[model samples]
Target: MLIIPAENAINWKRPPWVTLGLMMACVMVFLFYQGADDRKLDAAIEQYLDGNLLALEAPAYEDYLQREIRFEGDQQSVLELQEFQALREQDEQGWQAVTLLFDRDYYQYLQDNRDLIWSVAERNQWSEQRGAIEEQWISRMSAFQLGLVPSDLSLYTLITYQFLHGGWGHIIGNLLFLFLLGFTVERALGPGKFLVAYLVCGALSGLVFTGFSMGSQIPLVGASGSISGLMGMYVAIYGLQKIRFFYFLGVYFNYFRAPAIAMLPVWLGKEIYDYWFAGATGIAYMAHAGGLLAGAALVWLLGKSWLQVKEEFFEPEPEQQDEQFTRGYAQAMASVGRMEFDLARRQFEALRENYPDRTVLLEHLYQLAKLRPDLPEYRDLARTLMADAMNRRQPEQMLDVWNEYLSKGEAHHPLAVEDHNRVLFTSLKNHDLKAAEKAFERMRLKAEPDMVQEACRLLLAEFEKLQMEPKARHYRQLLRG
Candidate 1:
C-alpha cells in the first residue's frame, strides 16, 4: 500500500541536488548492503518452514523465531504452539499442520505475554523460543548494533538507524515519499538549512518514539522519520494550495488532487488512530506523527519568507503604481477634453516624472504623444520609452509606442535609425511580418550610409533564416548598393 504525491506544491529555481543525492545514496545502500540481509532472512525462514533440523542448527538461527514470537506474538500464534509440541513429540506431519495454519491473513502482532500464554504448553514453548534467541548472541547482531532501540538506544543509532531498513519494501516505500516531498521543502528552505532541519526532525521523532515505547526491545530502522519531516514542511509551505497525489492499495489505484495542507489532518488522524488501535504492528506510526509535528514546528520557528511562499502558490495583485497612474491619467485626459491642453500637458509630465513605475509612465506618455504632439515633452518621453523597451528586449512595449506614433499620423517623423532597426528585430521575433515591413521602410528612409549597410546585412541574415527568398533577395540588393 503506497500513497505518492504527483507534483510539488512549490517550484524551484534550480534542480534539488541534495534530494537527488539522498535518493541515490538510499538506492546504493539498499542494492549493495541491505539486500543481503533481506535475502538471508527470507531463506532462513523458508528453510525453517521446510522442517530441516540442520538449518535450525545454524549459529544463532533460533534468534529469528524468538524475536518474531516475542515482539510479534498474538492469540493465533499461541494456538500454533500445540502443533510445535506435536512435532517434537509425534512426527514431521505435525510440523506440516502448523505451517498450514501460519498461512492465514496477516494480523497485527502484540508484545503482551498474557495474550500469548493460555496453557502450560504455550508457556513452555514461549520460554524455549525466548531462551534460544538469548543463547545465540551472533544472530541479527548487525541489526541490533545499527537499529534504534527505545530501551537501550546508542548515540550513533540516532542517524545510522534512519539509513537502515528491515526489508526492501521498507526502504523503497520511504524513498518514494522522500523524493516527492523532500524537494519541495528543500526548495522552500535552501539546501543547507533543509539538511539541518531534516536530521534534527528525524532525531526528534526517534526521541518521541522512545518516550512512548520506552521498554520495547524491538529495533526501529528506515527513513520514515526524516521523510515525515519533509512532509510536515511541505504542508506548512503549501497550506491551502491544491496538489496532486496517486495512491495504490493492492490492485485498486487512483489519483486525486487536493489542498496540500489537507493531507496534514488526514495523515495525522490515520497515524493517531493506528497507534491507538493497531497495537505494536512493527510500524512506527508514532515516529511519523512526531516527525510531522517537528517538521511543521521547525518551519514555523525558522520562518519561511511569506513573500517567497506566496509567489510560488498564489497570483500577485496589480502593483500600487499602476492604479495610481490610471487615476491620474484619467484626470489629465479630462483636462484635455475641456481644451485645457497646457494644464493637461503639465499634469502628464509631472505624473510621468513622479511615478517610479516605468510601465505606467510609458503608457501615459503614449496617450500624451497622441493628444498633445506639439509638446516636446510628450514626444521626447515617447522616444525614451521606445529606446528603453528596445534595450529591455520587450517587443510588445516597442509596438505600443510605435503604434501610438503611427496612430498620430507621424509617418515622416525623424525617429532614430537604431530605434527603427530595434523595432524591426522585435517585430520579426514576435512573428509580426507586417510590423517588420513597416520598420524596414522607416529604417531605409531615416538611416545614414553606415547604418543602412548594417541594417541590410542583419535583415539578410534574418530573412534567410525565415526562408523568405524575396525578402532575403531585397536585403541582398540593398547590401550590394
Candidate 2:
C-alpha cells in the first residue's frame, strides 16, 4: 500500500485576494504620483519665468514651452525649456503667445540660466544656505515622519525628485527590480507592513541623497531606493534557500542560484562601485544604499515573528515523527512474534497511546493479552482490544476471541453476547427444557426478533412435551409473528 504524505495532501497555498488588493493599490498610487509629477512640471515653469530669468535663456525656454501643456501631451521633453515654459503658463491667459515667444527665445534662456541650472548653489549664497538648511531639517524630521517627509522641505523639487528617471535604461532597471522583489516582499509581509517598509526606505534614501550630494541641484527620483530594501529583506529571510532568477545578459538565458545572504553584499558593492568610479550620471547609488540599509534593519526588527508566521502557514508535515512511530511499532511487533509477552505488552501499550487508530497494533495487543490470560490486567486488556475491534467494524475478530475464551471455560472471562448466544443455542438443541428455559430467559433480553422466534419455537415444542398447552400456545403465537 502506498501511503500519501499528509503534507503533500495539504499544500501551502496563499489566498489571491490579498495579493490582488495590494497590486491594485500600488497601481493606483503609481498613477497618482504620475499625475502629481505633471502638475509639478507646470509649477516649475511658472516659477522660473516669474523670476525674470527667462529672457536671457529665451530660446531654450521657448523650446521647453511648446512641448505640452496638458496631461495627454508628451512627457519626453519634460526637461526641455519650451515644454517647461508651456507647462508653467498652462493656466494663464494668452498661453499660445507665451508658448510661441518662449520657443523663439529658448536658446537665450539656456545661455543665461545654464549657470543657474548647473551651479545654482555656488551662484546664490542665500539659496545655498536655505536649501542646505531645508534638507538638513527634512533629514532630522525623518525620525518623526516614520517615512513621510513633508512636501515643504523642497518646492516643485520633491515631486519630480520622487519619480523622475535619469534615462529609459535606468527606469526599466528599477521597474524590473520593483516587480520581482516587491511582489514577494508584499506577499510575505502583507500590504500594510510592506507599505511601511517601502515608505521608510524611500525617506531614508532621500536623506542619503541629500547628505551625499549636498550642493548638487540634480533632482533624485525612481523606486530604486525602496526596491533595494526589499532585496535586503529577501536575502535576510531566505539566505540559505536558492532563488531562481532568469538572467538576460545579452544572448544567454541561464538559470542560477544566488546564495541568499551574499545577494545583498554583492548588490551593495556594485552600487558603491558605480557611484565612485563609473560616473554618477544615470543611477542613484546612494539611494540604493540607504534603502538597502533600511530594509535590512526592518527585517531584523520583525524577522523572528515573520519566520514563525511563515513556518506555521507553510511548513511541511512532520514525516520524521511519523517515521519514528512506525519504527517503534515494528520493534513492538517483533517482540510479540518472539513471545516476549511483557516487553511486547509495554511497547504495544505505548504505541496504542501514541497512535490509537492503528488497528494492526491493537491486534498484536490482543495476542499479548491472551498469552497472560491468568492476570486480571490481561482480562481488562482483552475487553479493550475487543471493543476497539468492534468499533473498527471487525466483529468477527471479537467473536473469535470470545469463542476461544468460552471453550477454555475460563471463570475470569467477561460475558460477551456472542459467547452467551453460542452456549444458549447448544443447551436448547439438546432438549433439556429447564436448562433451555434458563438460557432462553437470558437470551430473550438481548436477542433480535429472528433469534427470539427460533428460541421460542424450541421452548414451545419442549413445553408441549411437558403438556403445558397454554404456554405452548403463547410461544406459537410469538413464532407466527
Candidate 3:
C-alpha cells in the first residue's frame, strides 16, 4: 500500500530554510559538481571494454564458477558468464560486460586467480589497464568519490553521499519527496534543530545500509534514506493524534483519518517486506526503514520537553470545514451584494459560529462590525478578529479596533489579557515593532509576569538589532523591572 500524510495548510511565518537549502545543495551538487559523472563513467567503461578486460576475465570467471559451485547467485553468474562468452565469440562485448563490475565476488575471484590462469605478461598488462580504469572512475565520478560504499565506508561518505544521486529521475524523485514533507517537518522542528535532525537521520540511514550490505563495494547514494526518516518524524510528531492519510492499494486509492502513529507499523511492514522479497532491486528499503525508526525514536525520546511540538501544526483540518461552508459563504456574499445587511450579518455570524478561526469570515465580519460600531456586539466581533488575524495579514491595523473600544485611547488598553498577549507576540514576530510596542506596553500592566517578561525581552532584542538605542534602552529598563 502507498500511504502518505494529507497536507496541512502551510504556515509561511517561518519559511523552511533548511529544507530549501538541502534541496538546493542536492541540485547544485548534481548540476555543477556531478555534471561530469556521465562522461567520466562512459570513458571508464569504454577504456575497460577497449582493453579487452571482459574477454580476458570471462574464461577465468567461468572456470572459477565451475569449481565454486556452492555460493549464492553463482548460478546466475554462470549464466551471465556463458552469455558473455557467447557474445564475445560473436565479436561483441555487450552491456552485460559492463555490469560484471557489480558482481564484486566474481571480480575478486578473477583477481585471486589471475596469476594461475593468464600468462604473466598478459595478466600484468590487463591489471595495469584495470588499475588505470579504476583510478579514472573513482577520481572522476562523484558517486564513487563521495557515495557510501559499505566495504570502504567512511565518516565523510555518510554525509556527502546523501547529496549524490544516480540520474535525473533519481534526484528529481528524491527532491520532490523532500519538498513534499520537508517544509512542514522543518517548521515543526524549528530551523536549527530541524537541520540537526535531518543530518542525524541521514547519517543513521547510511549506517543502516552499511550494516545490511556489509562488505559490498557498491556505493550508496541519493536522499531517499533521509527523506524516509522525515516521513517517520512527520508521522511520529503527530503520534496518537489522528490526521488524514492518502493510501493506495493497487487500483484502489482513498484518504482516511487514522491515528498518526498507526502508520509506523504499516510503513515498517512495507519496507521490511520489500527488503525480504524484492530480491535486490537496487532500492535501499533497509535504509528507508532505518531512517523511519531513527526519526520516530529520536522524536519520541526527546518528547515535548526537549523537542516541543508546535501543536498549531496539527490543528483541525480546515479544508473540510471550508469545503462544507463554500455554499453558505457564497450566499452570504450575495446577500451583501444586494444590501441585505441584516441577512448577511446573520449568515456570516452563523458561519462564524461553525468556523471561528477562519480569517476570511472574521475579516468580512470586522468590516461589517465597523459599519455598526455603536453596537455592543461590534466590540466582541473586533476582539475575535484581532485574535485570528495574528498569522495571516498585518495585525498592526487591527490594533485600531482595540484602540477604539475603550476610554484608554491606546494608553492602558481594553483587550482581555490573553488577546493582548496574542497581539503583542504576533506583532513582534511579524516585525511591526510600532504595533508590538503598543501591545507590549498595554500588556505589561495587565498580562502575567512571564508573558510580560518574554514580550519585553523580544521587543528589546528587535530594537537592539535595528540599533534604536533609545527604544532599546527603554525596553531593557522594562525587562530589568
> Evaluated with TM-score, which candidate comes out highest?
3
| Off by more than 4 A, model 3 | 9-15, 63-69, 73-94, 316-481
Measured by C-alpha RMSD in angstroms, how accurate is candidate 1? Answer: 12.3
| CA lDDT, every model vs. true structure | 0.68, 0.57, 0.79
* Error of model 3, residue 371, in angstroms: 22
Writing each residue's lDDT as its tens digit, candidate 2 over 1-481 gives 1110011122135533433453444455456434354444344345444544334334434444454425336443454544445555564433532443333234334435557544564436424432343344322222112222232235333333444443456556666566556656665676676766666666677777677766443346566777777777766666566555445556655555656666676677877887887652546788788777778777777777643225432333456558878899889878867978789889988988877777777777766666666656656656666567567666556555545654443566545554456555555555545555655665677778788877788778778888999889888887776
How many steric clashes does model 3 contain?
Answer: 0
**TM-score to true structure, per model:** 0.54, 0.44, 0.65
Off by over 4 Å in 2: 1-26, 29-33, 36-55, 58-176, 305-309, 313-481
Model 3 clashing residue pairs (backbone): none
lDDT of 3 by residue, 339-358 (tens): 89889989998998877776
Which predicted model would earn the best lDDT?
3
lDDT of 1 by residue, 1-481 (tens): 5665666443454677888888887778667766566455444345444544222222122232455568886443454455454554565543443343222121112124324433565445544543343334314544666778887877788877777776768877888788788877776676777778888888988888888888666677888988888878787776687877788899999989988778877777888899888864779999999998888777677664531343433332245456777788899889978978668877887886766455665665566566666556555667788877777778788798877776563644556677678787788789887787788888788678887787677678878998999999988987887
